[model samples]
Target: MASQKIATLVLVLGLLIMPFSIASYAQIPCNTVYNDLYPCLGFVMGGGKVDPACCSGFKTVLGLAKTKTDRQGVCSCLKSLVSDATDGEIKNAAQIPKLCGLNIPYVISRNIDCSK
Candidate 1:
């Protein structure tokens, strides 16, 4: 319950503040990014095989990140999505892209510098 509350707060905060964080330069919306990546939660939060749906979503989200700011906004949304994740969970999450056979331009981590 406590973790759920934290997750909710992080999502809400991200939704509320994401625009200000990347609005000037980002063309993609965090909500869209959120919806696109939600499918990966199962594999990311759990120790299991990655789903094809999650990979499909992953491809879509990565495809949308066309610019530096777009990537930053996507990163910010991803951080919010897994804000309550344990270190192991984050590691699992980070492996999804590679497991899906997709390459990204940024490092996947809880401490990712979205500004970069």
Candidate 2:
């Protein structure tokens, strides 16, 4: 009887939680995340590969700069994100706005492929 009750309770809990879980798992906009990120990266790398350690610091600084509406501060912060991201991720992220149908001429122009 105890086992049966436990099973029933588990079933009820699962059913109750399923909808919220589904809603919570909704897709995040990678383009937005990338847009928010790549500029900072460019500021960091200036024109080089990204490093992993710089990512966390970049995110934190970017968050703070964003709150204050400081473009220069945000650019300063991107220097770090750019220093941290892998070369591949940086390249991929640069392409995100275009992939999302955004006319990010400035960002796209910065890409190595864009000039070639």
Candidate 3:
């Protein structure tokens, strides 16, 4: 009876957790961000008004980050991109979210620790 109860409890727990696990695993691809945000590069590097497409891309990326792991994945991708960016571009990146009227939790910087 005790063994049956344990098995039933385990099955219940698994069923309860399955949907969350699936949702967590369904993060947007990192490459998708690169493709979406590509239009922002010219403005980010050149000190001009960001394009409307750039803002739309930023909104899409923000919307995809529904979990902590997803957010961290984005941070990692941003870190790599920023590493290759000019200082001016990095500055522009930091301002992009605010400029777009979006509230992102992580600052866009090469030095930001994405592990958090």
Candidate 4:
């Protein structure tokens, strides 16, 4: 159960690490970020097991960023979601990448600065 909660938080955190610029991401619009993230919301908000589909979506989204603008865009998006999370929640969420066997360039933390 504890692991489940952690996994849930991590999935949501992972969702905030991708870029969605249509031109850069092969026409992936920013709004569609929500579509991929939809399934993880319930788990992220309520605390439970993270879904495999959620991780799959996360992987696809994470792969979209390929430039500085992309990183900044993803960072901007991450800031909003990170704001609503508690320290513990953020810690758990940051663990998603590792849990999913992925390595991201940036660290997902509450204090993360999007401008960098």
Candidate 5:
């Protein structure tokens, strides 16, 4: 009975700590970026103006990227999303920061070396 109780306590402690560890591992959640930018798919595809919400979302993601690793993660996430987009769509995505009056340091492109 004591062994079972100790095992249960260990399991509970592991469960409690799991979320904090995962949260620390991924400082920026990519899903947030996807949710924020999904509204801009039409604009990115070259059919319409960027939505205010999209710009807001982009800014939020940009603000959250406070480190080099975070920035690279964002870039990698974006690259995967844009892989299926047309050349024009990719171009529009690359230009979003400029058009939105934001100042992102790196251009959004699949060709970018995220490791840097």
Candidate 6:
């Protein structure tokens, strides 16, 4: 009976931790980019060295890039998105999406300028 109870406890613990573990891993992309790029650019940023918690934060900024009405926040999110991108890709203008306008072309370009 004791052995069975221990097994049950282990299983429950594993189930509880599984989602959190997965979410942490998911944040690796953002974290890696932030750590690498921020130092060179002179901006202080960290997602705890690419652990799972960073991934949860990653989604928030990514979602902001897609549909947030706050234009300034959207521009700020760009640095996070491209922070992990390869060096060659960074210079390529076509690769970056233009967050100008729905129709009239507002051109919110300055907010995302992380380049030196």
Best by lDDT: 1
Which one is best on TM-score?
1
lDDT of 1 at 112: 77
lDDT of 4: 0.60
lDDT of 5 by residue, 13-82 (tens): 3433333322234576556557667666657755568888778888888888899888877776676566
* Deviating ranges (above 4 Å) for candidate 2: 1-69, 103-116
Per-residue lDDT tens digits for candidate 3, residues 43-87, read 775658988888999899888888888888777767756665557
Q: Which ten residues in a row have the lowest lDDT in candidate 4?
A: 18-27
What lDDT, from 0 to 1, does candidate 1 have?
Answer: 0.72
Model 3 residue runs over 4 Å out of place are: 1-26
User: Candidate 2 — number of clashing residue pairs?
Assistant: 5
Ranking by lDDT: 1, 3, 5, 4, 2, 6
Off by over 4 Å in 5: 1-25
The local distance difference test score of model 5 is: 0.67
Q: Write the per-residue lDDT of candidate 4 for residues 27-78, one digit (tens) a residue.
A: 3445455466556565555546777776776687677767667666665555
State the RMSD for candidate 6. 17.2
Residue 54 lDDT (model 4): 68
Task: Give the Cα RMSD of candidate 5.
Answer: 14.0
Model 4 per-residue lDDT at 60: 74
Candidate 2 lDDT over 48-109, as tens digits, reads 54433335433533354333224333333223223334555456555544443433224422
lDDT of 6 by residue, 1-116 (tens): 55643543354334333333211323323333333222222111211223333344334444433333333333333443334443433433122222111221222232354221
- Estimate the overall C-alpha local distance difference test score of candidate 6: 0.32
The models' CA-based lDDT, in order, is 0.72, 0.37, 0.70, 0.60, 0.67, 0.32
Give me the displacement of residue 23 in model 5, in angstroms.
13
